[model samples]
Target chain A: MREKIIEKILESGMEFVSGEELSKQLGVSRAAIWKHIKALREEGYNIESVNRKGYRLAERPSDLLASNNICHELDTDIIGKKVISFETIDSTNDYAKQIATNENEGTTIVSEEQTSGRGRLGRHWHSKSHEGIWMSIILKPNIVPYKAPFITLIAGASIAKALNTLGVNTKIKWPNDVIVNGKKICGILTELSAEIERINYVVLGIGINVKTMEFSSEIENIATSLYKEGYNLSRVDVVKAIIKEFETLYFDYIHKNSKLETLKVCRNYSAIIGKKIYILQGEDRELVKCIDINEDGNLIVEKDNGSIKEIVSGEVSIRGEKGYV
Target chain B: MREKIIEKILESGMEFVSGEELSKQLGVSRAAIWKHIKALREEGYNIESVNRKGYRLAERPSDLLASNNICHELDTDIIGKKVISFETIDSTNDYAKQIATNENEGTTIVSEEQTSGRGRLGRHWHSKSHEGIWMSIILKPNIVPYKAPFITLIAGASIAKALNTLGVNTKIKWPNDVIVNGKKICGILTELSAEIERINYVVLGIGINVKTMEFSSEIENIATSLYKEGYNLSRVDVVKAIIKEFETLYFDYIHKNSKLETLKVCRNYSAIIGKKIYILQGEDRELVKCIDINEDGNLIVEKDNGSIKEIVSGEVSIRGEKGYV
Candidate 1:
C-alpha cells in the first residue's frame, strides 16, 4: 500500500493532490492517507502539505535505496523484478545463498551497509555505512557448472559498460574486478551451488564504492570510490544502470548462447590486455603479457619464455607490474 | 565407548571375555558393560553370553552398516577418519552438505537406504533398503573450482579399480559411472559449494547397487546390480575397498596435484574407448567415435565430419550406440 501511494505521488509530477482526491482515487480513507504520508516522510521522503493544496512530493531521498526509487523507471525483465533493501546486513552474498533455493531468479538483495562483507577468495571487503552499493543477485541459469565462470565476465562487462555510460570511465580487470584510472572501484564475487552435470544456483555479489571518501591505509593506494574520484553520482542511478545493463547482457548470453556482446565489451574495455601483469598463485608469481580474452572467456597470455597459455578464471589473481590494478 | 567394546570383542578372536575382566579393562562397571552389550545386540550385533564366559562376539550382522564394521581395519589416513551411518535418511549428500562447513575434511556419511536419493542433473536414483552402498564423502580440497569435475573421474577410477581387484571386472564410463556387462552398476554424483577462486567443499556421493535382485522396469534394461550379475559380495567389503582406493587417489590429487594415476586407471579400464557413442544434449543427439582420453581428462571424439573435438564433462551425457553404457 505504501509503494502504491508512492507510485501515485511520483506519477503526480510536482502537482498537488488533495487528500480527498487521493482517498477516492486509491480507495483509502483520508485518515489512512495522512498516516501513510507521515510514514513516508519519516522514511526520508520530502513532502509539502498546505491547508488547501493538500500534498506534493518535493523530492525523493537521494541516499535511500527503496524499491520505489530504484525500480521507478528501471527497465529489465527478470533482473530486478523484486527488490529487497536493507539498512544493514552481514553479507548480501551469504543472505542470498540462504534464500537462493526458494527465491525467484533475478530477485535482488541490496544493503546500505555490511558488517561482514566479503570479496573473492574469502577476502574481507570494507563496506562502511551508506558508502557503497552492496548487493547480490540470485541467478538460476540452465547451463552446466563449467559454463559458470563466463557469467563473471558478463558481470564485469556490465559494470564497465554501465559506468562508462554514466560518464565514469572504468575498465574491467580481466575476470571480476572493475577499475578506474588503474585503481579498484568495483568487484564481483560469484558463488555457485552445483552438481556434476548442472548448476543449482549462482549468487552474483557486486560491491561498488560510490560515496566513500576515505580509505584505510592498507588499500589507500589501490582502492577508490566514485566520490573520491570526483564523480559525484547518486547511488540510485549507479544501481539502476547496472541492473539494466546486466539484464541485457545476461539474457543474451543465457538465452541465445552468444558471447559476442560480452566478449566485445570485455575486450574493448579490459584493463589488463596488452599490459605486463603478474599472475599470483599461492606463493608463486609469474609475470605474463595478456594477449586477449578468448571466446570461451579464458585469458590468453604470453609467458616470459615466449610460450602462449590460456588461463581460466578462479585459480589465479592478476596484478599490475607496479601495484594492484 | 560402544565402538571400543566392539573392537575389544573382535580382538578376543572367538574367546569369551568375562564381565569382571571387561569392566576392569574398559574401566566401567559390570552393569554398564552389560548395558552396552544389550545396546549392541539391539543394533544387530550377535553376542554369545555363557554362564561363566560372560560375553563373546558370535557374529556381525552382514546387513548392518555401522561405524564399527566399516572402519574396522580400514587403512586410510583421511578418507574415512569419521564414519556416520544411518539406517534410513532422505539423502546422504543432503545430510553431508548440511554439516560440511563445520565437519572435518574426510567425514563420510553412509545410509542403508535413501528415501529421496538424487542422481546427476536432478534425476531420481532409487536406493532400495539394505541392498546398496549409498554413501557421501565430504572433502575440503585446496584446489580451485574448475578442477573439481576431474574428482568425479577420480571416484570412477577408484570404483572400477577396486571392483576389478575383487574379480568383478567393472569398467568406467568415462566421467562418473561404472559399467559391468554394458550396464551401469554404479553412479557418482559430486556436488560443490565454491567461490570463483576456490572451492569450499565437495560432497562426493557414490551409489553402488550391490545386492539388489530387482530394479524398476524403466531402468531394468540399463541398470544392473552386483548380485544380479551373479557376484554375491558383501557390501561391507565393497565399501571398504572403494574407500581405501579412493583415499589413495584423492590424496594424490589434492596433495601432489597429480591426475596421472587416475587418468591411467580411467584409460585402462574404460568402456567407451574405440566405440561409437551418442552425445545427448537436450533433444539433440550426435553420433561420434570415442578417440581417446586427453591429458586433461577430456574425451577426445571424432565427429561425423572427421573433425576432432575435446568434450568436457558435465555438459553432455554419453551413451552407447545402442543404449546406456
Candidate 2:
C-alpha cells in the first residue's frame, strides 16, 4: 500500500493528486500516504506540497539502475540491456570486471554503496553509504588496444553533459574525473582484455556522489558531493540521465561511424582544453602553457621555453593557474 | 660442503679442481663431494670422472633456474627480480595480477604448474605439472591505458626470441600465443589499470609447456609442449631466458630511442611473418593473410581482398602454415 501510494503520486505527473484520492487508489489510510512521502523525502526526494494540494513529483532523482529510470530513455542496443543493482558492495568496478569477461556487451552493474571503493592509481574512493552512485558498463568494441583510452574520454564527456543538464557547470579534470566548482564529483575507470586486432571486452566504472552531506576531512578540499553543492538530487535521477547520455554517445560512436562522432565530440569536450595547468612531466611538476589536446586525447602542453610536449597518461594532474572554473 | 664443491667446480670454468682441494677449502671430506656429485647427476647435471684425474666438468645441462643458468647476461634495469619458484599454483597469472597492483616493478612470480591456468577470453590454460614454465612478471611501465595492449606484443616477442634461442621453430599467433607444430605451446596474458594518460601497473603472465606428457583428450589436438616435440629443455632455463629477453626489451622501450629497435627484433624473431591466420575480428571470426610486421610489433593482417589492418590484440590463432613452422 505504501509503495502504491508513491507510485500513484509519481504517475500523476502534473497537479497534485489529493491524499484522499491516493488513499482511495491504494486502499490505504491517508496517514499511510503521508508516512511514505516522509520516508521518500528523507531519501533525498524533492516532494512539493501545499495547503490542500497533496504531493507532486518535483524530481525523479536520475539513477542508472531505477527500473523505469535508466531504461526510460535508453536508445542503444548494446550499452545497457540488463541492469543489475546492488545496495552495497566492496567494489563495483572489480565486480563488473569479473562479469564483463563472462557476460556479453552492455551488462550494467550499478550499486548504491561501495565500502572498499577505489579510483585510478589505487586511490581510495570515499563512497559513503547511500551518498554516491557507482556503476559499470560492459563494452565489446572492435578496435586496437591503443584506441581503448578514447572510451574514457567519452565517459567523462557523458558525465559532464549530465551534470551540465542538472545546472551544475562541471569541468573535465584531464583523463576521467568530472569536477564541479573546482571540486571532483565523479570518476571513471576502465579495464579490458584483447588480442591486437579485436577488443574482448571493456568494463567502464563510473562513480558519482549525487547526495552527500559530510565528506572526509582528508579530501574535503578536493571532493564535493552533489547535495553538498546545494543540489540534493536523488541518486536514481542522476543514473537515469547518465545512461541516456551515454547511449546517445555510444550509438553515434559505433553506428554513425568507427571514428565515433562521440570521438569528435570528445576532442571538444576534453577537460584540459586551452587551460594552463601543471603537469608532472618527469620527476618535476612544471607549469605548462595551454596549447591543444591531441587526437589521441593527450595534452599538448607548451613549456616555459618554446617547445611543446605531448603529455599522455600518468600523473598529469591539471592545476588551474588562477582558479578552477 | 657439497654445495661449495659444486660452486668451486663451476666457477673454475675449466678442468675441475681435485676433490681434495674442494674438501680442504670447504673443510669437508672428499667422500662428501662424491656424494654431492651423485645427487647433481640425479638433478640432470652431467659430471665426468677420469679415474685419478678427479671430477672434471664435462658438460653442464643448461639449467632452468640455476643462478648462472639462463639470464646470465641480463641488461634491463627492472622487470625481472625476486623470482619465486613454485612447484604448482592455482593460477600464476591470477596470483601475479592480484599482487601487481601492490608490488613494485621487477617482481616476478614463477611456478612449475598451474592447477587452474587461464588463456584469453577466459579460457582454461592446460599446464601439465612439472612439464611447463608458468610465470608472471610485475611491470610498472610509464605509459597510458591505450598503450596497454602493446604489452602483449612485448611479452610475445620475448617468448618468441627465447624459443628461437632454444632451437624451437615457432610462430606467434598475433596478440599472445606461441605456436609450434601448429599447436600452441605458450600463452601470454597482459592485465593492467590506468586512465587515459597513465598506466598504474601491468602484470604479464606467461605459461609455456616445456614437457607435457599427460594430455587432456579435449586439448590434445590444439596444444603441444616442448618436451612433446623432442626439445630437451629445462623449465628454469626457459623462465630465465624469457626474463632476460623481457628485461632487455623493456629497458630499450624506456629509453624511447631504441624502443623501435627492440620491436624490430621482436618481429624478426616472430615466426608468423608470412602465414595464414584467423582473427576473431570484432563479432566475427575471419581468415586473414599475415602480411607485414610493423615496428610496433603489430601484425599487419590482410583481409581476403587487400584490406590490410594492423591488429594489436584479440583472439588470434595461426593456421597450420607450414605445419606451424
Candidate 3:
C-alpha cells in the first residue's frame, strides 16, 4: 500500500495531490496516508507539503532501488515477481541465500552498496555506494544441476542484449564478464545451491558499474562503467530492462531447452569469439583461438596444436592475449 | 584433554588407573583430573570411582558420535579430519552449508537426530535419536559443478561397498539409494554450493538406518535398518568404513579424473542393472529396462520403444516393478 501510494505521488509529475484524494485513491484514512508518507521520507523519498494545497513528490532518488519503480517497468511473468532492496549489505548473494528456500522464484535482492562483495574464485568485487547495480536474483529453475552452467550464459546474453537496447554497447567475455570498449563493465557471478541431481536454488549475482567514474589504481586500466564510457542510463531503467530480458531468455532456455537463442545473442555480442585468447590454468597460460559456442554453452577453442577442445568454465580462468578484454 | 583422558581410561582394559598416575601422565594436577572425570560423567560416560583404587571406565554410551570415536577409527587422510557432533540439529546438511565456506574441506557435521531432516525433493527423512547416522560431510573438490551428480553415485557405491564388507550385503539402487533385502537401508543426499565453473563446497549428507527397529506406518514397509536386517553393526565402525571407502573413491575421481573405479563399485553392487523398472517422472511412469552402468554415472535404460537413452539421476526417479528391489 505504501509502495502504491508512493508510485501514485511520483506519477503525479510535480502536481499536488491532496491528502483526502490520496487517502481515497489508496482506500485508507488521511492519517494513514500521512504515516506512509513519513515512512517514505525516512527511506530518502522527498515529499513537499503545501499546507492545504496538497503533497508533491519533489524528488525520486536515483540510488533508491525501490520495488515500485522496478516493478512498474517489469513486463515478464517470472524473474522479478518480488524485489527486495537494501541500503547496504555484506553481499547480495549472501542475503539471497538466506531467503532462497522460502522466497519465490524470480525474487531479486538489490543493494546500494556491498561492504564485502565477492567475485568468482574468491576475488573481491568492488561495489561502492549508489554507483552500480549490485543485485542477486533467486531462481528455482527445474533443471539438472549440470545444466546450471548454461544459466550464466543466459544471464550474460540477457545483460548484453538489455544494455544494447539501451544504446550501451557491451559484450560478454565468454563465461561471465560483460565487456565494453575492451574493458569490463559488468561481472556475472552465478552461484548454485543444489542437490546432486536437483536444483534447490540459484542465486545469480550480477554487478554492473553504472555511474562509477573512478576505479582503483590496480583495476583502472581494465574496468569501465556506463557513465565512465559516456552512456548516461538510469539505474532503475537498466535494472528493469535486465530483469525483463533475463526473464524471457531464462524461461526460453528452461522450458524449451533451447540454447540456440541465448547462444545467438552471446555470439553476436561476444568480445572473444573470433579472437585469440590465453587460457589461464593455474600458472599455466596457453594461446588458443576462440571457436564457436556450440549448442551447449561451453567455450570451444582451437589449441596451438590445432586440436579443438571444449573448455568448461570454472575449471580455469581465461585472459585476453593482451589484457582483460 | 577430556576426550584424551576418556580414550586412555577406555584403553586401560578394565584396570583401574590411579588418579596420581593419570595426573602425572596427563601433565595435570589431581584436582584437574577429578574435574575432567566430572565433565565425562556429564557427557554420559559411565566411569566408576573406587575410593583408593582409582577410576575405571565401566561402560560407554552407544549414542556418542564423538569426534574421538570416529576419528580414531578413520583410515582416510581426508573426509573426517574434523568431526563435529551435535546432540540434535535442524538438519546436518543445512548446518554444514552454514559453515561450509569457513570450514575445511574434510569437516564433518553429525547429529544424533534431525528435528526436520530433509530428503531429496522436499521429502521428510525420519531421523530418530541415536537410531541412525545423520551426518553431512563438507567436500571441496576442484571439479566443475556439472560433475557433482556423479558424486552422489560415488557415495552410494561407497556405502554399499562398506556395508557389504561388514556383512550387511547392501546394493545401490540407481543413483543414491542403498538397499538391502529389497528395502532401503541408506539414502545419500549430495548438495553443492558452486559457481558455474567451480565448486565452493559439496555437502554429502548420508543417512543410514543403523539401529532403528521400528518406523512410522507410512515408511515401515519400505525402510529397513541394519539391526532390523539382523546385522547389529556399530555406528562408529560403519561411519569409519564409509568414510574410508568414500575418501579412496572420491580422490580417484578428483585427482585422476577417473570414473572407472566408482563405476566398477557401482556396477558390482548395483541392485537394478539388467532389470525391468519404471521411471517415475512427475505423474507419468514409463517402463524401461536398465541396461548398464556406463562410464558416466548416468543410468542407461532401454525404453519401451527399444531405444537406448541416458537418464540423468535427477530427471527421473526409478522404482522396481514389484517393490523397491
Interface RMSD of 1: 1.2
What is the DockQ (computed on Cα atoms) for candidate 2? 0.22
Residue range with the least summed lDDT across 10 consecutive positions in model 3 chain A? A60-69
lDDT tens readout by residue for model 2, B1-325: 4445656778777675777877788877788878888987776677777666677667766644443443345444565556655557898767876777778898788765789988765788887566677777887777656555666777787888878887888766655567887788887877665544566667788888787776789878878888888888766667777888887777666556355755665566555667776665346667777777776656788888889888654434445343443
How close to the true structure is residue A239 of candidate 2, measured as C-alpha lDDT? 73
Docking quality tier of model 3: medium
Candidate 1 docking DockQ: 0.68
Q: Which parts of model 1 have CA positions greater than 4 angstroms off?
A: A1-43, A48-57, A303-307, B1-42, B51-56, B303-307
The sequence of per-residue lDDT tens digits that candidate 3 reaches over residues A1-325 is: 7778877787888898899999888899999999988998888788898998788878766557887767775788888878988779999999999999999999999998999999887799999988899999999999888888888889989999999999988888988688889899988888998887778999999999998998999999989899989999889999999998898889898998888889999888889998999999888999999998888778999998999999877777888888886
Evaluate model 1: give its lDDT.
Answer: 0.89
lDDT of 2 at A321: 75
TM-score against truth, every candidate: 0.89, 0.67, 0.89
Scored by lDDT, the top model is 1
Better of 1 and 2 by DockQ: 1
**Candidate 1, residue A194: CA error in Å?**
0.9
Interface RMSD of 3: 1.3
Best by TM-score: 1
How many pairs in model 1 have backbone atoms within 3 A of each other, for residues 3 or more apart or on separate chains, i.e. clashes? 0
Candidate 1 accuracy as TM-score? 0.89
